[model samples]
Target: MKRSYGFLLTAMAFTLVTLVPVGDLPAQQATASSAALPFKWEELTAPNFIKAVELSGGTCIIPLGVIEKHGPHLPLGTDLIDVRAVVLRAAQTEYSIIFPEYYFSQIFEAKHQPGTIAYGERLIWDMLQNTCDEISRNGIKKIILVSGHGGNNSFLPFFCQAQLASRKDYAVYLFQPPNDPAFEAEVARMRKSKMEQHAGEGETSAILAVRPDLAHQEVATTQSGEDLKRLESMKGVYTGIWWYASFPNHYAGEGRYGSREIGEKELNHQAEQLVKVIREVKADKTVLELQKQFYDESAQPLKTRQ
Candidate 1:
């Protein structure tokens, strides 16, 4: 009988990670139990880290965000800040190791704007793949990728699909929260601005909830958030330049009506939705089992049933 190398490495990592003295940990996290260990990966001492792996049931989350210009009013790190807030709140209820401030992601559409850190296409692909692999190496077998930037919608799915290109001991799950009608109705009833998207009313409200100082509501209306109708006749067509053609300033929606109250509602909804996902992922076993089956068949398809 052959022993598996992956298992051996995982066991060794777990052993070493549990050796740190509890006294060496920060005062806030020093006496905390498995249930109380800090959710942020960097905040956990080695001993607590192992406990976290157990507490999370080998589950973790990468709250993905991007460094890009968010209109003229919001800070460049708006996406990163907002996403972190949501994931941190969710983790409090669900108990998963949360990766810190991951802003390296697809953002070519905002390259023309200031403070956009758009890594090369290949680098972005390799970086994300390597990050997931590293997470698995550290004993986390389930990874949840939750992105706050809307631009990553397409890129994340493609990345998840590519996991099948090789046999992986762990599984990657993307968190795509749906629009709850009740939540939407509540927002709509209070929303004064009809055109909020990026730095618009909704986004500004979210920021206000997280970092009210960073959201300059008064400056939000300095620039136009309305679409300029640059590609009207080519409605059915799609092109890379479509976003820039319409909203070159990268501003969308009116932010003047943003309120901390509205922001609180949106954040609560997002965090609640993510908590549900964390629970589901922790209980999921079929995905990894199916993945293993697929990998085994792919290795020798002739032996598989016809």
Candidate 2:
């Protein structure tokens, strides 16, 4: 059953109170002058929210994740935990409004898993679109989507592309960090297992770094993480059941090999990269200008240049 928006909002508020520390005064009661403005959306008071939108140049970040099984040892919210950690760290360095826990994403493949929360396709789309619309309504003009879940790779890009289908006052930007060969080499040198996709060494290490208490490395070997190769014969064919066919256990790599050192290194590197991205996005004006120009041209296609 889909949770109501009211319930979700209330749940999110509760989550903020429990997970985020807002000092002596409650978040809503804290004055802007009392302390430094927090980057979290839920933590900002009504008055400070307006200041945050302006302070961030109408820029906001929605760190996307999903609720699903991540092997046997890692928690279901591993992606959310790690992504939020990275985004919060970056936002502190380069201020931006970080939206509260957003896990409503594509996770149909993991529906068979025990802890997977697979919202309907239509609902997920509407939820994201409405969220963006509401964010823009709140005076934010530039929205950045930083996704942590691998399943949202295709979904998020498609959503960004669909923003062009109709005219919008705000611009949406997807964060795609460029590859660093040096960092890749360092990771390769540190990791013992070469096969890693989900709940693997890299992912487990990430959880270890972010929330070591939640990571149970001792139970990592309880399930098989080996690829079943169920669809090996189907070459050049893309099937919806590919992931399930390949990794029936929903475990893809050797989590036993995960180390805290590798986890910290990866998280730090990602946060550093995100800090640069936020800085760049805050200074960028070309996207919005081009969006407006395109919207105008698109509306009158007959007058477009040949």
Candidate 3:
């Protein structure tokens, strides 16, 4: 399969430096039982990788994240950190090979903020496409995209749709967990802040629960996360600059009001939902079968049933 040249070079360089040859390990360690294998792709031995692919039934997850600045209180990698935490928890229940930290995602709106590593649109697209290609090449044909960053909300779905633009041996599935009314109502009752977006109460609480040492709730009140409503008049029209125009400080919602209890509850709920998704995707064959049928039809439209 074709891959991005730049990504290929980087991947080659990484493999050369970090990976030990399968033959280098002792015979016993190289042939260890699958029960001792780790779910993380990077953590698995070269030989164990094959076992993981088979154990997972060719299912693998790419927990997508972006390095963007959160509010003053939360770390720049809050989204990635939080999302991975949930993915890891779910993987513990439903085994799947988890990709390493992937922060190549859309973060153009947060470019104005410090510590935001917003790559060009083409680079991010190529990186993700090539990453998926590389994973599939390794025998894991069912790739699951579980995005932690809100910025990827649009990009991921579009990527999945674009897969149909051509024929692919592997299938790409995006994990979109539906909201549970009971959970939302519980969150509403626990939520102290009225506005909870970005590094707000919900996000802050999440960080506190996962990595309390990094969360600085005391400084959360240092910045204002309230919307400026700068472009309220253009309600019907959509513009790229809308996020920056409203939240110039790149901070939204009150983080000081976040609590660990709420964060733990939210994370558990998300993990539970993800566990279910992983199981469903593992058992699913219709998507790939349908894609094959669609591709064959697309190859010759005249032959398709009217």
Structure candidate 2, residue pairs in collision: none
Which parts of model 3 are misplaced by more than 4 Å? 1-34
TM-score of each prediction: 0.88, 0.88, 0.88
For every candidate structure, what is the RMSD over all alpha carbons to the true structure, in angstroms?
Answer: 10.9, 7.3, 9.2
lDDT of each: 0.81, 0.83, 0.82
Predicted structure 2: lDDT: 0.83
Which lDDT tens digits does candidate 3 get at residues 134-160? 998899889999988888878889999
Worst 10 residues of 1 by lDDT: 15-24
Displacement of the residue 64 alpha carbon in candidate 2, Å: 0.9
Give candidate 3's whole-model lDDT. Answer: 0.82
Error of 3 at 38 (Å): 0.5
RMSD of 3: 9.2
Among these predictions, the greatest lDDT belongs to 2
